[model samples]
Target: MHWNWQQEDWPHFAYNASALRSAEDAFLKGGGIIVGILHHVDVEARQALAIELISQEAVDSSAIEGELLDRASVQSSLARQLGLSADRRKANAAEAGAAELMADLYRSYQAPLSDKLLFDWHAMLMNGRRDLADVGRYRTHADPMQIVSGPLQAPRVHFEAPPSDRVAAEMERFIEWFNATASDAARPLPAITRAGVAHLWFETIHPFEDGNGRLGRAIAEKALAQSLKAPTLTALAETIHRHRKDYYAALHRASQDNRIDDWLAWFADIVTAAQARTTARVRFLIEKTRMLDRLRDQLNPRQEKALLRMFAEGVDGFAGGLSAQNYRTITDAAPATATRDLAGLVEMGALVRSGELRYARYHLALSN
Candidate 1:
C-alpha cells in the first residue's frame, strides 16, 4: 500500500479548519492566562516555572522516544542553563544534551525556523551517541528509513520515509512552509492547528536518523510559540506521552490518507488538554511560592530544608508522601528533631499529615 507521502496530492494536506474553532479559542484563552500569571509573578517564580516546564518537556519528549531520563537531572541541567541557583548535581550527557536543546528553544522561540536551526537541534539531541551513520544532519545511508516493530525476524513495517536523495529537497520545502505560515506571515494558520500540522508534517519527513519524535514535538511547540508570540509552557510532550499508544495509532491511521480531519481533531483535543494541565501546573507553582513565602523564617533550618526538597519533586510532591524517615534522610536531623520539624510543618499548614506514628506520611499542602 502507498503511504500518504506517495500519494498524488502529497503534502497538500486538506482539513476542515472551521471544525477546530473551539479548540483554537481555548488555546488562545489559556495562553493569555499563562502570560498574565507570568507577568504578575516575580523573576524567581518565572524562572522556576520555566525550569519546571522545559525540564518536563525534555524528560517526556525523551520518554516518548523510548529513552528514560532522570527528571531531577534534567531539571538541574535546565536550572543551570537558565542561570538560576541550582544544586551541585551534574547532569549526565543525555540529560544535559536534552536540557540544552530545550533551554535553547525556550530562549529563542521567536527566531524564524531554518535548516541550520534544525541541524543544530539534531546535534544537541544526538549528543553522546556513538551509533548512527549520520549525526546533526539528514540521513545519508542508501537503505530505506523504515520504522518497524516486533522481533528482528518478523518485523512489522509501520512507515517508510522518502528516499535519502529526496530528503534535502523535502526538508527545504518544509522549512519554507513553516516560516511562511508564521503568525506574521501573509497567510497564517491558527495556533493549535498550525502546531498540529507542523508536527505531523515534520514527523512524516523523519529527516534525522534518530530523535525525530522529540524534534517533531519541539517543532509543534515552536509553532504554538510563534503564533502566541511568546514561549509556550504547554505540556505537549507530557500529554502525548500519557497516551503514547493512542498517539502512535492516530499517526498510523493519518499516514494512510491526505484527509487528516480525524488527526487534526485528535491533536486539537490533545493541545486543549495540555493547556488545561499547564494551567493547573502554573497555579500549583503559584501556591508553592505562597507557601514558601508564608513559612519564611517560621520553621527551623531543618524544616526549611526538608520542605524545599519535597517541593523539588514538582506538582506530585515526594512520592507516596514524605515519611518521617524520608524527612530525616533529607535533613540529616535526629529522630526527635525530625518529629518536631514534621509537627511544626503540619501545624503551620505547610504539610498535611496522614496515618499514625510509624505509618505516618506527610504530604506537601500545595501538592496537586
Candidate 2:
C-alpha cells in the first residue's frame, strides 16, 4: 500500500472543529466515572488490576518477550529484568513481569510530563531484557524497516520507518504538534480523540528499530491520562486488545490516506467501551469491598488480617490462586493453624477450595 506524508494538510486534521468537540464531550463523561472508581478502589486490588491490564495490553500489542515466555517464566524473568530479589515464579510469569512494568508506568502517570519523553520511557520499558523487549536506544543500520500486516503468506508492509536522519526530525514535529494541540483550550479536542491522534502520529513517525506499536499505545495512554488529569482506572489496554485487528486496520487506513476521521471515530468507540467495562469492574469491586467490610465486622482481628492479606497479596501470595504454604507464610501460622484459617475463609465464602487436601489452592470468590 502506498502511504503519503500529509505535510501541508496536517493541521487541517488537527483543526477539525466538529470532531474535536465530539471527542471532548465523550472524554469528559468517560473520564469522570474512571476517576471516581480510581479513588474508591482498594489500593492492592486496583494496583493488581492495573498491572494486569497494562501487561496484557503490552503483550497483545506485540511484546515478543511476553510471547516467548510463559506466565511463570515471565515473572521470574521480570524479577531478573527489574533486578528485584523475588524467587516466586508462578504459572503466569510473563504476565507478572509485564504487570510489574506496567504498574511502574501507571505510577508515572500520576505526575505526567511531556509526550516527547516517550522515547526515554519506551527505552526504559525494554532496557533490561533485549531478547523479547526491543530496547531501541541507538539507531540501526537498516533503513526503512518494514511493518507488515494481514496474512503471513501475503503479508503487506503497510508502513515503513523513515530514514534515520528524517526519523528524528519527523518525531520532533509530531511531538510539537501533539503538545501544542493537546494544551490548546481553544480547540479543546476530547481526550479520546487526542489519544487517537497520538497513536497515529507516533506510528507514523515509527522512530525505533522495533516496539513502536507498544510505545505508540503507551503514548496514547499518556494522552488519555493528561486529558483526564486523574488516576486512570479504566483498562483501555483491554479494549485495544479486544479490538486488535481493528486497531491495526485503523492505523493502516490512516497511514494509507492520511485521513484520521475513521481512526478518531474508532478510537472514541474503544475509549467508551473501555470506560463502560471499567465501570462494571469498579462496581464489582465496590460490592466486593462492602462484602469484605461486612465479613470483617464479624471476624476477629486475626481472621480480618488473613482476609486482607489474601486480597492484598492475591490468591495465595501469587497473581492467581494461593497454596497452603502461602497461608503459612502470610499468617505466620503453624500447619494446623493455617488449615483452620483456610477453613474459616472457605466457610465465610471469601475463598473457594480447589484440588484435594494436600494440593489445595485458594481462589478469591470476588475476583470473577
Candidate 3:
C-alpha cells in the first residue's frame, strides 16, 4: 500500500477552507480575548500563565510520545528559564531539555524555519540520551522507518515514512514550503488551515528518527504563532493528549490521501477548544492573583502552603476538590489544624466548602 508521500500529488494538500470558516473565526476571536485579558493582568500573572501553558505543552507533548515527564520539574525548569522565582527542586535531563525547547520556541516564534533550527530542536529534545546513533540530525540508517504495532512477526504497519536516504531532500522541500507559507507570505493560507496542513505534512515526512510527534506539534504551534505574530500559548499538545485516540485516528485517515478537509475540520476544532481552554487559564490566573491580593497576609503558614498547592493544580483544581486529609498532606498540618485552616479559608472567602462535615471538599473561590 502506498503512503501519502508516495501519492502522485505528494505534498500538495487539498482542503476546502470554507468548511473551516466558523472554527477559524472562533480561534481568532478566542486569541483576541486571551490577548486582551493578558494585557490587563500584571506582569507576574502573565509570567505565571506563560509558564503554566508552556509547561503543560512540554509535559503533554512528551506524554503523547509515551514519555512521562515530571510536571513539577518541567514547570520549575521553565520558571527558571523565564527568569522567574523557581522551586529548589532540580530538573532531570529530559525535563530540562523539554523546557529548553519550549522556551526557545516561545522566544523564536518569529524566526523563519531552517535546517539548523530543526536540527537544534532535535538535539535539545534528545539531550542525555545515549542510545540513538543520530541526534540533532536526520536519520542516516538505511532501514525503512515504519510505525507499527501488534506482534513483531505479524505486525500491522499503520504508517511508513520515506526511506532514510530520501530524508535530506524531503526535509529541504518541507522547510522551503514552511517558510514560503509564512503569515506574511504574499499568498499565505488561512491560520488554522496552514497549521493543520503543516502538522500533517511534517508528520508524513517524519523527518527525525525520534521526537517527530513532539516536533511536529511544535511546528504547528510555530505556524499559529506566526499568524498571530506572538507566542500562542494555546496548550495545543495538552488538548491533543486529552483526545489522543481521535488525534491518531485523524492522522492515520488523513495520511492515506491528500484530501484533508476532515482532518482540517477536526484540527480546527481541536485548536479552538485549546484556545478556549487557554482563555480560561488566563482568566484563572487573573482571578488567582486577585484572590491572593485580597487575602494577602490573612492566613497562617499552613493555610498559605495548602492554598498555593491547590492553585498549582491550575484550572482543573484538585480532582475531587481538596479534602482535609489532602490539605494536611500538602502542608504537613495535623488533622485538627487542617480542619481549622480549611474552615478559616472558607470563612475568608478564599475557598468554597461543599458537602457536610466529614464529606466536605474545599475548592478555590477563583473561577475554574
Candidate 4:
C-alpha cells in the first residue's frame, strides 16, 4: 500500500486555488473587523501583541503535548508578551514555554540541520514537564516505533548507532532535499503542499528516538512559515488537536498509499478551517470589547474594573452578579460602599436586580 511520493501526484485542482483565495480574502476582511474591535477598546496596540502571542502559543502547543500546558500558564505568558501583569502566572508560563519552543523550531532550519538538532528541540519542548523529556538525545534500539494503531499498528525500525550507517546517510539526503526543495523559487509550491511534504517526509525519516510526531508537526509549520514568508496567525495546531483522530487517520492513509493529493487537500482544508475559526474568535472578542466599552462609559473606575473582571472571568469572578458581597470581593470595598456601588450600577441600567432584596443578584443589562 506504499505509494511513492512524486511531483506528478499534485493535481491541477482549480477548486483548491479558488478555495485558498477565498480563505485569504475572508482572512483579510476579518482582519479589518479585528482592527475595528481593537480600536473600539482603545487598545489597538494590543492587536499585534495578541496575534504574536497567539501564533507562538499555537506553535508551542502543537510541538509539545496538547493540553499538557495549563490555562494559567498560557495566560501568564500572554500577559508578559502583552506587557501586562499576569494574574494567571501559571497559564502565562505554559504559553511562554510554548512560544520558546516554536521560536526554536523556526530557527532550526537556517541551514541543513542534523537529527541531533531535532532531538534538542524535542527535549526543550518536553523539558521541565512530565510527558516527553528523557528520550531527547537517546535512541530506542530494542523497541520498534509504532506510528499507526489498531489493526494497522505497523512497527518500523530506525537506526540508533553506527555500522548500519545508511540510515544516517538517507536522513541527511532527506534533509538536503527538504532544505533545497522548500527554498527553490523556480518551482514554487503552495504552503499547504509544502506542509504536507514536510510532515510526510519527516515522519518517513523517523529521525528522533521519540517525539517524532511532535517534531514532524513542527517541521511542517516551519515549511509553511517559509512558504508564506510570514508568521502563521492561524491556530492550525489547535485545529489538529480538535481533529486528532482524523489527523492521524489522514497521515496513516498518506503513509500507506502515496496518493498525496488527498493529503494535500486535507491539509489545505485544515488551514482554511483554522483561519476561519481564528477569524471568528477575533470577531467575537471584538464584540465583547465593544460591550465592555459601553458598560465602562457609565461606571466609575472601581466599578469598571469589577465589571471587566467579571467579563473576563465570567461566573468565576463573581458569584452571579454584583451583589453587595460580590462587589466587596471584586473591588475590595466595604459592605456599605459595595451596597452604594451596586445601587448606582442598578440605577445607571448597567446592573439589573433579580429576585427579592435578600436573594437579589445583579446581572449586566446586556442589549441585543
Candidate 5:
C-alpha cells in the first residue's frame, strides 16, 4: 500500500511532545538571539546580510530542485531588486526570474497565502523556461507523479503524490489547516511546530506540475517568516542542500504510521542551524568592520584593498593569508612597493609576516 499522511487518523499526528521540547526550545532561543543581535546592527549591515541570506536561499533552493543557477547572476538580480549595487554581473532570464521570485518572497511573505498567489509564484519560477508548458497551473491530468531515481528505463519511485483528482481537494484541506492551525490553540500543533508539518504536508500534496519542491520550501519560508514576524529568509535552503540526503530521509521517515518526532526535531535543527550560520556571518562582518575601523589610520590604500579582498572571500580568500605577489597583483603595485606595503602592515600589527624572504606569507594579525 502507498504511504499517505492525509488519512483522517493522521495529522493529529501523534508524537511525543516531550521529545521535541528541548530541540524546539533550542531552535526558538537561537532565533531570538539572532533577531536580538540583528537589532543593534546598522541598516547597511542588515541589508547586506539580507541580500546574502536571500541570495543563498534562492540559489540553494533552486539547487535542491536540480536547477543549478549562477550565484553571481542571482546576486545581480537580487541587487537590482533591492536597489543595491553588487559585482555588476549580468543575469540571464532564469537567474533574473529566480531572483525576482526570491525577492518577492522576502518582500511579501507578510502577505496572506492563497491559491492564486501560489500559482503566481509558480509561474515566476518557470518564467524563462522553454521546457515547461504548464508554467503556473496545477496538474490537470491524472498522470501519476512520483519522486524517483535511476534511469528512465528502470525507475524506482520513492514516493508518489496524491492522485490528480485528489490534488485540488488535498490542497484545499492543507490550506484550510494552515489558516486555522496558526491561531487555534486548541490544536495539538503549535504554530511554530506547524511549519515543519506544513513543509511535509505541502510536499506530499505536490500540487503544481513543476516547482513544487521550490514552492514547498517557499511555503516553509513563509511559515518561518510568520513565526519570526520578520522579513528575512533564514537561508535554510543551503543547509538543506548540504545535507539533502538526510533531508529526504527525514520527510520519508514521517509516514502514515503518524510518528513525526524525528521529522520535527530535524526541521527545528535545520532552522536553528541556518540561524546560527547567519549569526556567525553577521558577527564576522561586524567584527571585520570594527577591526578595519581600528586600523583606518594604520592601513594605506593598497593594504586596505588587500584586507577588503580577504574579507570578501572569507575562508578561501587567502590560503595561508595574502602573499607579497598577491598583494602586488591585487593592488597593481610594483614588487618593491608590495614589499613595502606588506612591511608597513606588519609594523602596524595589521598583519604578521611569516617565513624567510621569498617564502614569506602575510597573515592577518587577528587572534586565532
Candidate 6:
C-alpha cells in the first residue's frame, strides 16, 4: 500500500511531544535573546538587518527551488514592501512579487490563515513568472504530479503528492489547526512545533504547481513569527540553503512515511540555528558601529566601504580576505590609489596585511 499523511491514523496528526521538549526550551531561550537584541539595536541597524534578513528569506527560499534571484533586487523589493526607500531599481516581477507577498505575510502576522491568503501568496509568487496562464489559482488539470530528476526518459520520482482534487480539503484541515493557535484551546501541537508541522503538512499537500516549496516555507515563517509574537526576521532559508540536500531528503521521507519525528527535529534544529544567527547578526552590527567609531578618523570613504564589505558578507565577503586587487575592485580605485589606501589602513592598524609583495593579502585587524 502507498503511504502518505492522508492515510495516517495519528491523533489529530500530532506526533510525540516528549521528543521536542529540549528543542522547545532551546528555541525559547534563543528566541528570547534574539527578541531582546531586536529591541536593543538602533532603528537604522535594525532596519538594515531586517532588509538583509528578509531579502535572504526571499532569495534563499526561491533558491531552494533551484531559482536564483538577485539579492540586491530582492532587497529593493523588500524595502519597498516595508515602505522604506530603495534607491536601487525596482525588482523584476519575480523578485517584486516574492518581496510583496512575503512583506504582506509578515505585516499581517496576526491575521488568521485562510484559503484566500494562501491563494494571494501563490499569485504573488508567480506574478511575473506566470505572466499570462493564470498559474497561481490552482492546478485545475488532473495530470500526474511527481517531483522527478535526471533525464525525462529514465526519470526518478522522488515523491508524488495527493491528487489535485484532494488538495482543497487537505489544506482546509491544515489551516484550521494553524488558526487555532490563536485561541485558548488545548492545542494538540505546541506553537513552536506548529511551524514545522505546517511546513511538512503543507508541502505534502503540494497545493500549488509552481510555488509549493517556496510558499510552504513562507507559511512556516509566518507560523514562526506568530509563535514568537515578533516579526524579527528568522532567515531560516540560510540554514535550509546550507543543508539543501538534507532538507529535501527529510521532506521526501516524511512524505513517504507517516512518522515525522525526525523531520520535526531537523526543522527545530534549523530554527535554533537561525536564532543563533540572528543573535550573531545583531552583535555584528553592534561591533561594526564601535569599530567604525574607533577607526573613523583613520580611513577614507573608499577604504571604509572595502572594510565594511568584509564584515557585511562574512565568508562570502571575500575569498582570501582583503587584498589590494580586491580593494581596488571594491572601491573602483586605480591600482596605485588602492595600494596607497590599503597601506595607510595597515599603518593605522585598521587592517592586517600579509603575504609577500604581489601576493600580499589583507584581513580585518579586529583583534584586541
Best prediction by lDDT: 3
- Candidate 3 TM-score versus the reference: 0.94
Model 6 lDDT at residue 204: 77
Q: Please report, in order, the local distance difference test score of every candidate based on alpha carbons.
A: 0.89, 0.64, 0.90, 0.58, 0.78, 0.79
Candidate 5, poorest ten consecutive residues by summed lDDT: 183-192
Superposition error at 219 for model 4 (Å): 2.4
Candidate numbers, best TM-score first, in rank order: 3, 1, 6, 5, 2, 4
What RMSD does each model have against the real structure? 2.5, 7.3, 1.8, 7.0, 3.0, 2.7
Candidate 1 TM-score over all chains jointly: 0.90
TM-score of each: 0.90, 0.67, 0.94, 0.62, 0.87, 0.90
Off by over 4 Å in 1: 80-88, 318-343, 353-361
Lowest summed lDDT across 10 adjacent residues in model 3 is found at 182-191
- Over 15-69, each residue of candidate 5 has an lDDT whose tens digit, in order, gives 6777767766775676787778777778887888788778888899999878899
Badly placed stretches (over 4 Å) of model 3 are: 83-88, 332-337
> Which lDDT value does model 6 have at 50?
82
**Per-residue lDDT of 1-368 in model 4, one digit per residue for the tens?**
32233224322222335445554455445545444544544455355445444554454455445446554455455455445555544444335655555556544434344667766676665555555434555443544433433444654422212212234665666666566656555455556666677787666556555556767777776666565554445567767777777886687666544446677678777776766665555554554566666676677787887777765553223566556677788789887787788888788766678877768787766542
Residues 128-199 of candidate 6 have per-residue lDDT tens digits of: 674334475666558767888999799998888888887777788888888876424346455558888888
Ranking by lDDT: 3, 1, 6, 5, 2, 4
Better of 2 and 6 by TM-score: 6
Model 3 agreement with the true structure over 1-368: per-residue lDDT tens digits: 88889999998888888888888778777778888988988887688789989999999999998999999899999888877899977989999999999999999999999999999999999989999989999998888898999998999999999888898999899888888888788668778998999999999989887999999999999999998888979989999999999999999999899989999989999998898899888888888788888888798888888888888787888999888889878888888888888999999999999999889999998755
Flag the better candidate by TM-score, 1 or 3. Answer: 3
Task: Give the per-residue lDDT of model 2 (tens digit) for 18-81.
Answer: 8657656866886786666668776776654554444445555543213543533443544444
